[model samples]
Every structure is written in structure tokens, then in C-alpha cells.
Target: MPAAVVDAALIVAAVLDAMLMAEADRPYAVVSTTVAALALAVRRRLPYLVFALTLPATAVSSAVVAGAVALYTVAANTRNRRTLAVCAVIYSVSCAATVGNHDLPAPTRVDLLVSVGYNIATAAAAMFLGQLVQARRDLQQRLAEIHQVREHEQQLVAQTVLAQERAQLAREMHDVVSHQVSLITIQAGALQVNTNDPDARTTAQTIRDLSVRTLDELRHMVTVLRASGTAPTELTPQPTLAGLSQMIANSGIETRLDGDLPTDVSAAAQRAIYRTVQEALTNIRKHAPGATATIRVRHDGDTIEVVITNTPATRPTVPLPGAQHGLIGLRERAELLGGTLTAGPTSGDGYRVQLRFPATTQ
Candidate 1:
């Protein structure tokens, strides 16, 4: 049930019970009783205060339910046992004092004993019910924590397996792939020297150059994969504003860099800008092929913003495999740097990604 519904029900029931028990003579009793009963609306937030308001009503016949419910709420929410005991005792005394408000003569010994015993028992019952509710709430919180811990453990296990596999793959690439690529480079260099034909010599030289670049890229990957033992590690020498021009040229899409942004921003801010552009360009390639992209980096006051917008794809998009967490990681990183990232489809049937962050940080 919704909490609002439960609260409404409690207030209604308490008011109706108060009306039934109220004497017809005292209009003030009716008003006071109703006010105390209505106070139940905020019992969850101010349990002790609400109970105190209900205490005066407890010594009259009109507000029986209000006092009991208020006492119960205090017991359910309060963690201090001594405080709860004190509240319970006060409630019992007020309830027993209700007899003094009755029309009958001063009560005999047996009646007084019964009144005290019965009121004490009622307060005890409310305490027990409240304690039961408190225990259930604590149990539910513990169960939620257990579920979260279980999920974290599973992620750790999956990461360990992935790290082991990458380590093994790195070894193979270093020993087998690197060795073959080196041999190809050597053979291409030899052919370039020994060939007499101009075309063959030129082709060998091209092959040698490509092989050497491949070896360098391969070594970079191997080093990264081998070092990633416990977490998903990004490649070293991460891209920044200094490489923005070169990256745009190499992205394979028709693109324009539209701003001359500052280069003195902290390295973290630069990487955020670089990654935002890189990811935007990558998505354009995958999901919006043949699209034209415009990257605009702006510095206004102490804030830097990068806006990458792409026109609609000129060709049909081919489905590609991706982890799909690039934007999530970027969003998380931006928040860590006191920044924000937003991406969505444009009004012109295009896509746009915007990244904003503070320009300077210690």
C-alpha cells in the first residue's frame, strides 16, 4: 500500500474513534481530540513531538486512538531504549488518568488497580508491535546490502577472468605476432634494397614503413593489456587537446574543427574534451556513416564546452559490436570533474553531444 493511503486511513480511523468516545458536553474536547488525531499525518517525521501533542488528549475519553497510535509510532522509530521506555510510561500514566475525567465518584482500590494495569498493558502492546516493525525494517535493509555485495563480488570475478584472458593474449601477441611482424619488416627492407625495378622497390619501401608502424601499435596494445590486472585500464598517452586536430583528420568522416580553445586547461579537462570528441566521432562512424560532423569548443568565463554535431547518415548504418558503456563512463568522469555531458538526437534528424566543465583546477 502507498504510504499516503496508510496515513489517510490512520487519521480517519483515529478521528472516528475519537468522536465515538467524546462526551457531548465539552466542545473543547472535540476540538482538542480532532487536532491531536490529525497530528498523526506527520507522525513518521516527528514521532516524539506528535506523541507529546497527543498526551494531553490521552487523559480525556475523546482521543484514545490518537494516543495509542502516537505511542506506537515513537516506539517503531526510536532507537534509544530508555527514551522509548520513558514515552511508554508517560502514555500509561495519561491513559490511567482518563478515569479521573469520568463522572463516577473517586474509584475504589480494585478499579484503580485495573485502570493502571490495563493502561500499562496497552502501552506494552504498542511497544511490542512497534519493535516488531523496527526489526522488519532493519532486516530488509540488511537483505538489500547483501544483494549489493553479491553483485559487486560477481563483477570482481568477471574482471579477474577478463584480466587473465587479456594477459594470456598479450603474451601471444608479444611472442608470436610481434616476432612475425618484425620478420616482415626485415624482409621488406631487404627487398627494397635488392630490387632493381623502381615499382617493386617503392612497394617494398611502403610495406616496410607500414610494418614498422604496425609493430609500434602492437607493442602499445600488448603493454596495456598485460598491465591491466584488476581493472579495465585505458591505453597510456591518452588523447588531449594537443591531438584534437590530428584526431579529426584521421576520423575518416568529413569533419570541421570550429574553435581555437585554450591549451593551458588541466590535463584532466583536456582528456575529457578529447574523449568526448573521440566517442562522438566513433558513434558517427558506426551509426551515422558518411555523416558530416562539426566540433565546436568554446571557452566562456571559467567554463569550457565542447559541442559535436553530426548531420544525418548518408548511407545505411551497419550493426556493429560495442560494449555500449563509453558514454556512461564519460558521463561519470565528467561528474567527477565537476562537469556535465549530454547527448541526444538533434531537431534536424542529426545527433549532438555536448560536454562542459570548469577550466581550471588544482
Candidate 2:
């Protein structure tokens, strides 16, 4: 109901309680009864305040009901131990005042005790029921909060698992397919130079042969990575740092490499570095075709750095389409080895990628 309507209803109830108190032979009935009735207006919001206001006026029978309502309100809305203790004291006082006011004979005193006991018991039951309801509400709210937190944690876990799986797949593709395709490209180039028939002579023949071999190796890698239908070791050879130079050469891009690389680098780090170099070259082939590229690897005191750069092409560069997680995966791998990777367009408009990996001292 609207505020005006609720206030009008409260005014009517207070007038009725005042009139009822006037019929009794109580002293200061109107003033005391009006105050107790007015307290009911804010009983639920301020339960203990209502109990304090109504307890003094509870000498009158009409005000006794108001005190009981206030006690019920406190039990329903609050779980404070002090509030409960105060209500218990008020209830005992009200019960004593009610029994003392009644002028009964000795035999009826037993009846009065039974009636007062039942009334106190009934009031206690209401307070207990309200407290039970409040406890249930609090438990439900906590459960909802816990469930929401669990769902948020589950979403984070799922995203992390998906990211790790993508990185692992990228690593496998670079390891198995890149090296095999590079070998096929080199063998095809040698054949092109030795073959003499114009009909049989095709520059595209080298790319086609390499792509076929790459597909076969990719299928085998997929089977191994699945692990459910096949053993991981049954797949083809796992490449090491030795295959990186050939990978850079196979994409029909001119390249230069310098410095002796550590062959003993961990297999995981080696695969990550090879993939980084291959991705850089593939980006060059797609974005800066016909541009000469250089990949330089250097071993510092406790770090290994790989830098790949290419000259700007005559045409504008277009980004390649894929998962777009290649560079992100490379960065993650570098970070796992306590290193870093950077990729961006150079000042001369060519693309450049640089990566650093920390070496294990042992």
C-alpha cells in the first residue's frame, strides 16, 4: 500500500487500542497505550526500539499484545544474542505483571499459573519459529553466493584449459609439419635443377610435393596427440634445433642465419623457438613476398635470443588468417622459460619478431 494509506491504517489501529485501554481501570491508559501502538509502525525495521517503547506500557492488557508483537519482530529480523536476551527479560516481566494484576483465590492461582505458562509457551514458540525462518533465509543467501563463485571459477578454469590446448597444438604442428615440409621443398628444388623435360618442369611442383608431405605428417601428428587411438611415440620423428634453418629456407624466401645455437636446449624450448621462427617467416612470405629475410640466433651468458627481420615488399602487406594465437602462444612459451618475445612492424615498414629464452644453468 501507499505511505498515506499505511499511515491512515496505523492511525485507526492506535485510536482503537486507546479506546480499548480507556475501558480498563488502568492508570494513564491513553498516553501509554498510544505510545505502545505507535511503536508497531516501525516494529520490523527497528524491532528492539519497539520492544523498549512497548515494555513500559505493557502494564495494560492492550499493550501486552504490542510487546509480544515487538518480541516476534526482533526474533524474525535479527539474530543478535543481546536482542534475544532483552526480549526474554521483557516476556518474563510481562508474564509476571499479568498474573499479579489478576485478583484470584488460592485454588484459581494454580489455574492462573497454568494459563500464564501456556501463554508464555505460545509466545516462545512464535519467537522460535521466526528465528528458524531467519536462519533458513541466511543459509539460502550464502548458498547462492557460493554457487555464483563456483561458476565463475569454472569459467576461468575452462578458458585456461582451452588456451593451453591451443598452444600445444601449435607446437605440434610446427614440430612435425614444418621440418618435413622443408625437407620436401629442398628435395624438390634439387630435382627441378636436374630434370630436363619442359613438360615435366614446373616451379609449382616443389610447393605441391611439400604440401603433400606436410599433410601426411600433420595426420600422423594428430593421431599421436589424440593419444586415445594411437601411441604418441608411433608418430614420425620429433625435430630439434637442427631443422630450424631448413624450415626458414623452405618457404621460397631468401634467408640468412648466424651464430652457433645450443643443441642441448630443452626440447620444449627448442620447439617453441622453431615455431616462432617459422611463424615469422610465414608472415614474411604472406605479407612481404619476394623480400629477403634474416634469422639470427645468439647465446648470451644465460639467455638465447632469436631475431627475424625482412625488407619491405613493393605491395601493401595483408595479415594471414589463422587462430591468431601463434604469437600469443609463443609469448606464453617464452614466459614459461622465464623469457620474453616481441613482434611488430619495423621502422622501415618491414615486420620483425624477436624472442629471448633463459637457459637452465644445470
Candidate 3:
């Protein structure tokens, strides 16, 4: 029960019982009873003193409500069994002797024994009730501590699982992507050696050099992932809007990017825009050979939008094996950030990829 209700109930019970059973005809009796009952108001702060104050009422009349309540409070707040035992005995004695002290006829032996036993039992009952309340409080505190430990264990388990998953991703990047880039480097080297045209040889040498650089960067990324750190080690700077022009230049695609993005755009949003454009350029390289591309990034009210359009292939394109996972991953990322991504064939037999997400900072 709530503390306020318990206190109110105790005070009300003591006051009503004292008024009903205390000797009202005698002024001293009335005063003692009233004081004893009121003393319970401070029982929690001064348990022994309150119980002592209640003794006069318990000794003179059958209204032992205040003494009993005060004894109960003492038991609940204290753990000293010896002190509690003495208090219990004193309260029992006071209740038993009340009958003889009130100018009644002297009681016989059996009646006296029964009266003493009953008062002893009452004192024991109050003490036991208080002890029960204390035990319940202790149990609740223990359960709360156990709950906190379980939460900590759950967090540790989650981190362990994340580390395992990151290790798996690093393995795939090294095994699959690294092998392909190495083959590209070798093929470019062969082309550079066998070709007679100076222009073709120069192009092959550029391809070989770019492939080697990409492989080295990929290895650096894989090493960082394999270490399983919470924050990635910055082996190289993360790509941002500032690097977009250079990225497009290195992609070997004839593409034009127009429109301005705010300098204060959020880092995650800028990275998303960079990756989306990079993925679009990769698709065009494989599926739309000789296609000229245009990219436009704009801020429309609260929206940050980017659109990539590529003309249809100008020459016969090789059928490259693809599962379109890049676009699927981009769509999932957009959804995670409360955004949308759409891609389809344009009116001029071209392809278009558009992304829209809530504008950040800017």
C-alpha cells in the first residue's frame, strides 16, 4: 500500500479507538489517551519515544491502539531483536495490568493468566506484521538489482553478435571484391603490353593504376572491419560532397553534375547522395555503354532530392551478370532514414534514379 494511506489509516484507528474505550469521565485519563494517540504521528522518526508516550494509555484502559501502532513501527524500522523483545514485553505487561489498575475487582489466577497470554499474543502479532512489511521491501530491492544485471548481459550479447557480423562482411569484401579487382589489374597490364596504339596503351596503364589503388583502399577497409571496433578507423577520409567532382572524373563516364548543395548538409545525407550517384555511374558503365549522364541535386522546401539520368547505350552493350542488389540496398537505406528512392526507364529510352529525403540542417 502507499505510505500516505497507511499513515492515515493508523492515525484514524488510534484516534477512534481511544475516543471509544478510554475513560472519558476522568480528565487525566482523557489527556493521557489523547497524547498517546497523537504521539503515533511521529512514530517513524522517534519509534522508542512514541512507544513510551503510548504506555500511559495502554496502562489505564483497553485502548492500546497507539501503543500497538508505535510498537509495529519500531519493529519495521529496526533490526535489533533484543531491544524489540524488551519493548514487546513492556507493552504486553501494560495491557495485562490495565484491568487491575482501573479500580476493578481483583482478578483470579486463571483470568489473569488468560489476560496476560492474550496481550502477549497481540504484541507478537503487531511485531510480526511489521517484520513482514520490512521483508517485502527488501525483496523488492533485490529484484530490481537482478533486473539491472539482466539488462547489462543483454547489451553485451548484442555487441558480440555485431562483432561477428562485421567479421563476416570483411571476409566477403576481401575474398570476392579483392579477387575481381586483382584480375582487372592483371588484364589491364596485359592490354598495356600487347596494344600497339599509344592511346589504348595509355588508357590501359590508367586502368591498371586505378585498379591497384582501388585494391589497396579495399584492403585497408577490410583490415579496419576485421578489427571489430565500434567506430571505424579512418584509414582514408570518408567521401563527401567536396569529392563528388573528382569521383565523377575518375569514374571514366561522360557525366555533368549541376545544382548546389548546402555546405551544412548532414554527414549521413551527404554520404548517401555520394553513394547513390556512385552506384548509378557503375550501372551505366556496365549496362549503358557510351551513355552521357546528368546529375542534379536540389533542396525543395524540406526535401533534399537528387536525380541521375543516363542516355540509352550508344553501342551494343555486353550482358553483364547483375542482381540489382545495389539499388535494393539504396532503397533500404533510404527507408531507414525516412526517405524514398525510385528508378525507371526515362521518356527518351534512358534510365533515371531519383532519391528524396528530409533536408538536414540546411
Cα RMSD of all models vs. native, in order, equals 18.1, 11.3, 13.9
Which stretches in model 3 have alpha-carbon errors above 4 Å?
229-362
lDDT of 1 by residue, 1-362 (tens): 99899989999988898888877687767777888889999999999889998887787773678888899999899899999999999999988878888788989999999989989998999999999999999999999999999999999888898996676566445434554565566557667877999999999989888887887788678767767643233344555688878877866778988888677887777777777787788778667867899999889868888999999998766444343345765675588679899999999999999998888743
TM-score of each: 0.57, 0.48, 0.58
Candidate 1 vs 2: which has more TM-score? 1
After the best TM-score superposition of candidate 1, give how far the Cα of residue 25 lies from its true spot, in angstroms.
Answer: 2.2
Off by over 4 Å in 1: 187-207, 230-362
The local distance difference test score of model 2 is 0.66
Worst 10 residues of 2 by lDDT: 227-236
lDDT of each: 0.79, 0.66, 0.78
Comparing candidate 2 with candidate 3, which one achieves the higher TM-score?
3
lDDT of 2 by residue, 1-362 (tens): 78557645754665575676443666665666678778788776787788787766665453455666667778878778677866766675665565454455543767768856766774687588768878988999999999999999999877666655544664556544554554454445445656796545586474656565564556455445433221111123555688876666566778888777787788767866777877787666556755888888898768888999999985443332333445765776677777899999889988889998787722
Model 3's alpha-carbon lDDT is 0.78
- Which candidate should be chosen as best, given TM-score against the real structure? 3
Model 3 lDDT per residue over 1-362, tens place: 97678777888898899889887787776887889888887888899999999998898888878888988998998899899899999999889868686666788899899999889998999899988988998999999999999999999878877776666566445434654565566557667878999999999999888887887788677767767734221122446888888778876679998898656677767767876887788777667867899999898768888999999988666434444545764675566557999999999999999999888532
